[model samples]
Target chain A: MLNIENIDVNYGAIRALVQVSLEVNEGEIVALIGANGAGKSTTLRSISGLVKPQSGKIIFEGKEIHNFPPHKVVEIGISQVPEGRRVFPLMTVLENLELGAFSRKDRAGIKEDINNIFLRFPRLEERKQQPAGTLSGGEQQMLAIGRALMSRPKLLLMDEPSMGLAPMLVQEIFNIVKEINQTGTTILLVEQNARMALSIANRAYVLETGSLAMSGSAKELAENEEVQKAYLGH
Target chain B: MLSNFFVQLMNGIALGSTYALIALGYTMVYGIILLINFAHGEIFMSGAFVGLILVTVFHVHIIIAFLGAMLFCMIMGVIIEKIAYKPLRRSTRLAALISAIGVSIFLSNLANLIFGANPTSYPPTKEILFPVKSFELFAGAQVTNLQILIIATSAILMIILQYFIKNTRIGKAMRATSQDYDTAALMGINVNKIISYTFAIGSSLAAAGGVLVGIYFGVVKYNMGTLVGLKAFTAAVLGGIGSIPGAMFGGIALGIGEMFAVAIGLSSYRDAIAFGILIIVLLVKPTGLFGTEIQKKV
Candidate 1:
């Protein structure tokens, strides 16, 4: 339920995104796959209002949101789990989750949701009072996802959640992402891990440099010769 | 002689509590935004004037006047942040620092123009809080009821502030903002509002310190904040610039150290002694006692 149309973004002299366009329909896990500097994160950042585009519009559920700030974007049911997890380093795990629902006013629902999250991430529950920075890589990734879920966003834009994790933890995170989609939350996942991302995504787009290079069903893209050569390393 | 020494210690505590009150403002603002808020001392100075106007001009009760001064300074602090500091937030740290110094100069001059450069003495304490009374300890050492009032009130306010920072939802938001500004905004925390709230709380504490100092020392001057503000800043840095507990400890330590210096026949070097202690402490621990070493990610 989100449409980004021909948005151009720049960082002074460097062009980060050049007329980039993409879309995510409701209940679909849309994966944006690219290499190190292929503008995947930039696209997500523009949608989240962290980076304002120079042209074109970002339509979320039919309203243009290109002018909104990061907080306003969250208020409208779009939450972003930023690159590097970015959890409050000094705060307890529970407090991090509490801040995730900062825009909500339902006290009882917040308490219940926190409990639900604790059940889902039992390791976090065990260290509920511990500072988030002390969490291991895998656990911090879980905390980041859990924190995003706390906001109850209809659309969760996650950037590089699988980065810096062990291979086993990466598999676990991919499984959790699929499970989250099964529960009906639309996801816009930006990742360099194309193989795992394509395996779980309903639809996928390949970004080369700053523009969309290919788009198709996950299965078709996974089998495409050029995609296999460039992204999947087959 | 020993009892007289204890008497000086008590007086030092009374004075130190006032410094601690002002230092809290410094530490909290620095913790969140990393700006020194040099104008804060002027906020404290304005607090005394606010108390003076309420007491002398409006004839309000001392308790009400104290609260009034705090409320007035809280608003002033927020306004100063909105006007002076907020615009410079996105600029370099140097720009914000320069803006702070400018605000400090502007505020002090404004106060000087309004109240004149002369020092104004507070009304007699006997007419304000109950009749002034004294208690005698061993060796003819004495403590006034007003001294007890200042010390007890400061303690209670500090406890309340500690509770606020530790337990409240807004406080949690503040902690989050201080840790990561963008992440807090992504979580839908209005970071600007949190910053304003910080200024309000810090300014109010400084105002409370100002009123206490006005009553304790029996005089308020346009530039009273200069030395006291510097010492409070030294205290904040000495205790660990951004740590709440560190600010409290730093203020009290600096106050007691100054008094003890005076006691040991070093009264001529009183101000120099405060900075000297700060320099030595900082040299030993560059981050101050509570400041965490900045962790660099490769």
Candidate 2:
């Protein structure tokens, strides 16, 4: 459904990604796993148009989007839940979700989607009037996902959704990710939590430094000795 | 003496309403894009002259002139944002600020060339609207029709603005944009469009204030915005740089404070007092009363 080919990205003097290529087919949850500064977040950022690639192409369902601005990228049905759950700190939860659908004009459908989000995350329904900044880390993560889902995206890019949650909350979040995938939204997930990511992801790629080091079926990569030693800490 | 005090207090309210109106333009633009928009004061000055032109040359009613000035400045604000602020969005904050100051100087000079640097009085209010009259609120406490008109119109405009920001979808997008620019774009909001809209709304309010100032003070000048603009900006900072309510409160407080100073025969130091309040506010609460502290994400 999405293809990134030989993309290079830089931040001034620092090369953030070098020759990074990856793909996600329809109805798949693809995980990009790596350590800090391993180009995982940069790859997702490049696809979402937050960071433009110096070279290579990003084709989403066939059309190139590497050069599109971030707002236009979302208009083409791509939504990103950025790292650290950057929800609008001063906006109420409902306002945050309403902004999620800023590019869309279907008021009734937008309202319906918001209700569905509330149903999925009942705590959000209870705290709809509260400022998002007041939410706990776990709840803020939920709000971030729920906000992205408000756009009715064809492809969702989730960056480190499990970064700072309790173990049980992390499990709950992974379960929710699987549930979202089952509902027909293709996902490109970047994570440092390899075990939980591999458990849910259909396929996985391991990135080292600024380059892709390995790719395979999720099970095989999980069982691979090198991935196990380096990522899984076994 | 006490009646004189009451009359002066009423005058302060009318004057402060104008300050609050202009201060909102500063605060809103600052909240969204973090630009001080030094040119904003020029926008106010331009509004007064535009109203004057419409009233004198076109022979329009005072109300029509007021609305015309607002519409003119609304477009002016958008044009200014696109030309001056948009190109510098990705550049350093200082670059945009310098560009803003440049625009301010250019606008004021342009106005001077057109209006000839002379202070022009508005048409007599009794001739245009109603008889120049005053209501006796109490012993020596009187409010003129003009003062009442200015205060009421400003209050109505402010309420409408408040409603628009609180209840509308675009308003929600605005708040989101102000909170986090990147995250707002990620939600598919055209951040540029929101910025332009913000400029339009704020400029309209400032223009309205400009017209009211002309009516209340009976005089308008090319460089009028220089001092009023600074006062409005001070009001914004005093209230908390980005807080809407803070701007409102700060303007009134400053207005009343200035009136009290004048009452105590310290009128010459009124400007100094305003800046003194700003310094003290910054020293005590640098964020302004309502300014939110930006959180650094890990």
- For this target, which candidate reaches the highest DockQ against the unseen true structure? 2
What is the per-residue lDDT of model 1 for residues B1-298, given as tens digits with 9 covering 90 to 100?
8777877888888888888899999999998898988988989999999998999999999889999999999999999999998888878889999998998999889989998989998998877777778788667888888889999999999999989888889999998887787788889888899999999999999999999998988899999988889889888988888888988888888888888888899999999988887788778986788788645332
Separate DockQ for every predicted complex: 0.83, 0.88
Instruction: Judge candidate 1 at residue A198 and give its lDDT.
Output: 92
* A1-234 per-residue lDDT for model 1 (tens digits): 899999999987889999888899999999999888899888988988878999989999999999998888898999988888888889999999998999899999999999999998999999999999999988998999999988899999989889999999999999999888889899999888999999999899999888889999999999999999998898
TM-score of each: 0.95, 0.97
What's the distance in Å from true for residue B156, model 2? 1.0
Worst 10 residues of 2 chain B by lDDT: B289-298
What is the per-residue lDDT of model 2 for residues B1-298, given as tens digits with 9 covering 90 to 100? Answer: 8888888888788888899999999999998998998998999999999999999899999999999999999999999999998999889999999999999999999999998978998998887788878888777678898888888998899899889999998888888888888888899988889999999999999999999899888899999998899999989998888788888888877888888888899989999988898889889988888777886553
Evaluated with lDDT, which candidate comes out highest? Answer: 2
Put down candidate 2 lDDT per residue, A1-234, tens digits, no spaces.
Answer: 899899999888999999989999999999999999999988988888888999999999889999998889998889999999999988889998998988889999999999999999999999999999999999999999999998899999999999989999999999999999999999999999999999999999999989999999999999999999999999
TM-score of chain A of each: 0.99, 0.99
Q: Candidate 2: where is the Cα deviation over 4 Å? A: B296-298
The CAPRI classification for model 1 reads as high
Candidate 2 clashes between residue pairs 3 or more apart in a chain or in different chains: B240-B288
Query: Which pairs in model 1 have colliding backbones?
Result: none
